[model samples]
Target: MKNYILFFAAIWMTVCFCSCDDGRIYEQKVDIARGGRTLKLTGRFSGLSNWADGYSVVVAGFNDKSEYAVITKSLPVNVADGSEIVMTLGGIGDEVTALKLCVVNRLRECVVDFHTIESEELAAVTDTIMINAGTLDVGMYSTIQSQVFDKKCTMCHGETGSASGNLFLTAGKSYDAMVNQPAHKNSDILLVKPGKAEESFLHLVLNRDGDTNMHHLDLFSEKEQLSLKLIDDWINDGAFLNNK
Candidate 1:
């Protein structure tokens, strides 16, 4: 009789366990107002060059009316060039029916193809997404070296020897020599003030808008000549070390 009772009790417990197990299989959804949960991201960086400074993985929300994605936030990623980057990104609002992830250059310019995930797609993934940020452009610094200085002014400012104006248009030294440092000719003016474009002597020299009537070089409208506004944009953008 006792054996029969023990067998019945064991059967009852098994049934209860089976009932609770059914609740565990369900979808995980984000609360619309609470800004959703963070997702783990693993990705590879490719084709990074000396000019490729820093990078960021940005997440954007979708606009229903426009059927477009606009970047809402960015996850700053700091990793060595050409290495796999592993990080987590948040700010995924529940209302975000679609998500766009992109790798951007230091200037926040998109360098790689963007990945888009719909709400239905995101729900299907159990955990972790692997993304690859492929080859970025050589970027502004490289552009300046190859086109601006190399073609126009490297005769006076190159790394082969001591450059005139104490500026070296070498592969790696030009950015530092220009940013935040005062111009060789004028102490009151900066060569390339990081956040101050108009005040930079380089801009004044190129556009001939400085206190000194001395003109360095005028930018020609020829297709080959870089626009003078590029100098202004570079300086106004917080002239980052290593083009950060």
Candidate 2:
């Protein structure tokens, strides 16, 4: 019985050791098989240093949640000068079918710019892809700007002096001025809340619900109504400033 127990223990220990050692080798083999290459990103000449001290380029799997997961990040790239910046992504897995790019502020951890690229599109690219400055294709904030604020709200709240209720709905300034900020009339209600659109004063006024009796008759128009829905959707989708 003692010999039998000793033999089984020896077998178990050997199996454990082999399995642990093999796992690493298996992973390394897979990585080699998957292969990798460097991807270059070129962007327009914009003084990024005006916004943040430094920036990082992040890549992640092609999913809404994975977009912010930061699978890999580049070290700080020079953003101080208006000269063109080229960011190189090394060891990008061949299996990365679809991916998103996130340019983040190193200090605040906020994404200043974002974009999505498909594998097919990447394959077709011979040269570095040009990045749009301060734009995100899938972000809720950009949708709101193009659909809602630019179409309707800008009439009253566009430029600084023209903005009514001390609110500015210009492209770059709108997010900061409204997000988590108090309403002009009602200090208790926020103009836009990150995840709670129903609680937002903007939703209340547009829908003519709650204590706010003021409703824009223009909202009854089909275009304006669609804009209102887009705004509501934007708020529901975490009210993200840069990327979805």
Candidate 3:
């Protein structure tokens, strides 16, 4: 009986040692899975415009086929000019094809991408990834010109010799043609009245309920609500040619 008791005690100790070792291994894995895989972003925003209620800037992960973000974290918009910003996105799964610093609408759709980390680059990361984006300019008017006017409106307005409503939305000419300029349809209303979106004819014509013969609302899809809001905010913020 004494011999049997000693043998059993030795086996118990061995079992306890193995159990503790396994527990430590499991905890380490859990910790890694929870917080080890991360992407850190550091940069300063230069020409940021006023962000509206439904629109925001964020660091997000996405796949190739979808516009909707898989994971996202909102960036601070109230920071002073040239303030160094640091943001991190943790627990990034293998399914993420790309990571982007971009403007997103309320539906989490990426409106415009300011910076991108491609899948090939992301795959190289075994652990934490650090990226310095340098300085990004996120002014609303430039974004509006590039994304909306140049792409959508210039064909009818500036690209053709016969500009619609005598408005030219092409680059180098759009700012002067719109801001504080009188609308051809209504001489009394300004195309973009500084500090007042409600009084701006450009804002009014973009909306569905606005009294206009032309269905300008059709030009912008459901995906462009953020763009529309940006225009309104730009007008409300004095419609400057340069926010810097």
Top of the candidates by lDDT? 3
Model 1: per-residue Cα lDDT over 201-243, one tens digit each = 8777777744656556554454323335555665676765443
* All candidates in order of lDDT, best leading: 3, 2, 1
Tens digits of per-residue lDDT, candidate 2, 4-84, equal 999999999999999999999999867745556455666543323222124344544332333233345552435443455
Best by TM-score: 3
* TM-score, cand. 1 vs. native: 0.43
lDDT of each: 0.58, 0.60, 0.81
lDDT score of residue 50 within candidate 1: 26
Whole-model lDDT, model 1: 0.58
Deviating ranges (above 4 Å) for candidate 1: 1-137, 222-226
Error of 3 at 6 (Å): 40
At residue 138, candidate 3 shows an lDDT of 66
When summed lDDT is taken over every stretch of 10 residues in candidate 3, the lowest stretch is 46-55
RMSD of 2: 13.7
User: Candidate 2, overall lDDT?
Assistant: 0.60
* Clashing residue pairs for model 3: none
lDDT computed for candidate 3? 0.81
